[model samples]
Target: MIRVVLTDIEGTTSSLSFVHDVLFPYAEEHIGEFIKNGFSDNPEIQEQLEAVAEESGVSANDLDGLIEVLQTWIREDRKETPLKMLQGMLWEQGYQSGAFRGHVYSDAAEALRSWHDRGLRLYVYSSGSVKAQKLIFGHSECGDLTPYFSGYFDTRVGLKRDPESYRNILDQIGVAPDTVLFLSDVEAELEAAETVGMRTALLVREGPLPETSRPVMRDFDEVDALLRKR
Candidate 1:
C-alpha cells in the first residue's frame, strides 16, 4: 500500500549510541582543529563561520571563540545550522579516513534493500544536515546504502517536530500523505507527521512499547512484514 518510506536516522535505522557515543564525539573532538586548519581557504566553511558569527553575536574575527561556541553547541545538542554543517565536514573526513563507519542495523540494511528492490522509494528525514545524512548512508558499514534512498531532508526544511515540515516534504516529494510511511523512534516526530495524515510507525528498537495507536515496530524486519500485509 505504501509507495514511499521516510525514515529517521539516530534510533530508527541506526543505533542511538552510534550517534551519541560515536559520531557526535568525533565531531566534537575535531571541529576546532578542522576549523582552524581550513578557515583560510574553504569558502564554504567561511560562509558557515559568518553564519555562526551572526547567530551567536560572536565577532567574525574571533575564530577561537567561535570554535568554543561550536564545542558548546555540540555538548548542548543545539540544532544550529552552522554547527550541523561544520560537523558534516568533520564527519566526511572521519568517514574517508576510516576512523569510523556509519552504523546501520543489520535488519534495517536488509529490509531497506528489499523495499528498494520492490520499487518502494526510500528517503531519509533527520535533524542532521543533508551532508551528514549522506555521509552516514553513503559510507555505511553496510557498504554504501545511498543507492537505496532517493532523497534526504534535514532541518533546513523545518524542525522534525513541526507538522509543516512533513507538509513541506510531502509537497516536495509529490506524494499523498497516506501513501508515505514515516518511521522514527521519536514519538513527537511520528505524531507530527501523523498530524499531516502521513502513515506513522514507531521504531522501538529497544525497550517496551510506548502508549500509542500507531503501529510499533521492533526492527526493520517487523516493518518489512507490515509492508507485506499491506
Candidate 2:
C-alpha cells in the first residue's frame, strides 16, 4: 500500500511557465537590490551568501561580486542551495505583496485534497527550498492547501537525482521505501526514487514521452486510480 505520496512542485503540481516566466524573472529583477539594501545583513542571508562565496571562490564581503554570481545562477536556473534559499526569500516577499498567487493545477488541487482526505500522507520534495515549498502551497490558487502536506523536503536532504536522498526521505517519514510513491516530471528523479525502492510515476505534461520504463501519468486522477488499484 502506498502510505505516502511525494511530489515535485514545478511541472508536477504547477506549470513550468509559472516558474520560468513569473518566479524566476521576479527573483532576477529584485535580487540585486534585495542584497544591496542591507537585507544581506540578516544572519541567514549572510550565511547563504557565505556559502555562495565559498562555492564560487569569491569573497563574501564583495557583495556586488556575489550578487553578480547569483544573477548568473538565476539565469542558468542552477540548483545551488544558496540560490534556492535566496529565491525563496524573494518569493516570500512576492507572495506577501499579493503580486501573484502560486499556481496549482486544478487536477492537482482536487486530487491532493482527496488523497489527504483518504488518509494518505502527502509530502513535497522539490529542488526549491522547503520554505519556498510551503510558501507556494500556503498561497496556492486552491486556497491554502498547505494543510494537506505531511512534510516537505528540499536539497538539504540531498539532490533529488541521488538515490540516497529518497532513502533519507523514507527514513525521515518513517515509512518503508516500498510504501512511498514518488511523482516527478523528470525521469532521472523517478529513477532515483525507484532505485531506493520507492514506487515511481512520471508526470508527462506534454510532448513525446521520454525513454523510460516508469508508467507515465498525464494527471493526478490517473495517479489516484493507480493508487486505488494498489
Candidate 3:
C-alpha cells in the first residue's frame, strides 16, 4: 500500500511557466541588489555560496563571475544545489515583499489537503532547494501547505535521476519502498524511484510525458484513484 506520497512542485503540481517565467526572472532581476546588500550574511546564502563555488569550479573571490554563472544556470534550469538555494533566498524576498505569491493548481491544493487529511504522509522532493520548497508551499496560493507535508527534500539528498537518492530517502523514512509513492513530471526521476522499489506516477499536467513510458496521471485525482485501487 502507498503510505507516503512525495511530490515534485514545478511541472508536477504547478505550472512550469510560473517557475521559469515568474519566479526565476524575479530572482534574476533582484539577485544583484539582494546580494550586494549583504544578503550573504544570511546563513543560507553563505552555505549556498560555498556550494555554488564547488559546483561551478569557481572561487568566492569571483562573486560577480559567479552571479553571471548562476544566471546562466537559472536559464538552463540546472539543479545545482547552490543555484537552487540562491533562488530560494531571492524568492524569500519576493514572497515577503508581496511581489508574487507561489502558484499552485487548485486541483493540486485540493488533493494535497485531502491526502493530508487521510493521514498519508506527504513529502516534497523537488530540484528546488528545501527552503524554496517550504517557501512555495508556505506562501502558496492555497496558503501554508507546508504543515501538510511530513518532510521536505531537495537535491542535497541526491540527484533526482539517481536511484541512490530514492534509496536514501526511503532509508531515512524507514518505510517499505512499495509503500512509498513518488510523483514527478520527469520519467527519469520516476525511473530512479522505481529502481529503488518505490511506486511511481507521472504527473502529466498539461505537458508531454518525460520521453518515456511509465504509469502516468493527469493530476492528483488520478493518483488518488490509483492509490485507492491498491
**TM-score of each predicted structure versus truth:** 0.98, 0.97, 0.93
Give lDDT tens digits, candidate 1, residues 1-230.
79999999999999999999998899889898999999999999999999999999999999999998999999888989889989998999999999999999989999989999999999999989999999999999898899999999999999999999999999999999999999999999998999999998999988878888889999998899898888
Give the TM-score comparing model 1 with the true structure, all chains together. 0.98
Q: Model 2, 104-150: lDDT tens per residue?
A: 99999999999999999999999999999999999988899999999
Ranking by TM-score: 1, 2, 3
Instruction: Flag regions of model 3 displaced more than 4 Å.
Output: 207-213
Order the candidates by lDDT, highest first. Answer: 1, 2, 3
The residue pairs in collision within model 3 are: none
What are the lDDT figures for the candidates, one per model?
Answer: 0.93, 0.92, 0.85
CA lDDT, candidate 1, residue 34: 97
Instruction: List runs of model 2 lying over 4 Å from the truth.
Output: none
How far is 153's C-alpha from truth in model 3 (Å)? 0.5
- Candidate 2 lDDT at 158 equals 97
lDDT of 3: 0.85
- lDDT for model 1 comes to 0.93
Per-residue lDDT tens digits for candidate 3, residues 80-120, read 88888888878988999899889988888888999899989
- Among these predictions, the greatest lDDT belongs to 1
Q: What is the C-alpha RMSD of each candidate to the true structure, in Å?
A: 0.8, 1.1, 1.8
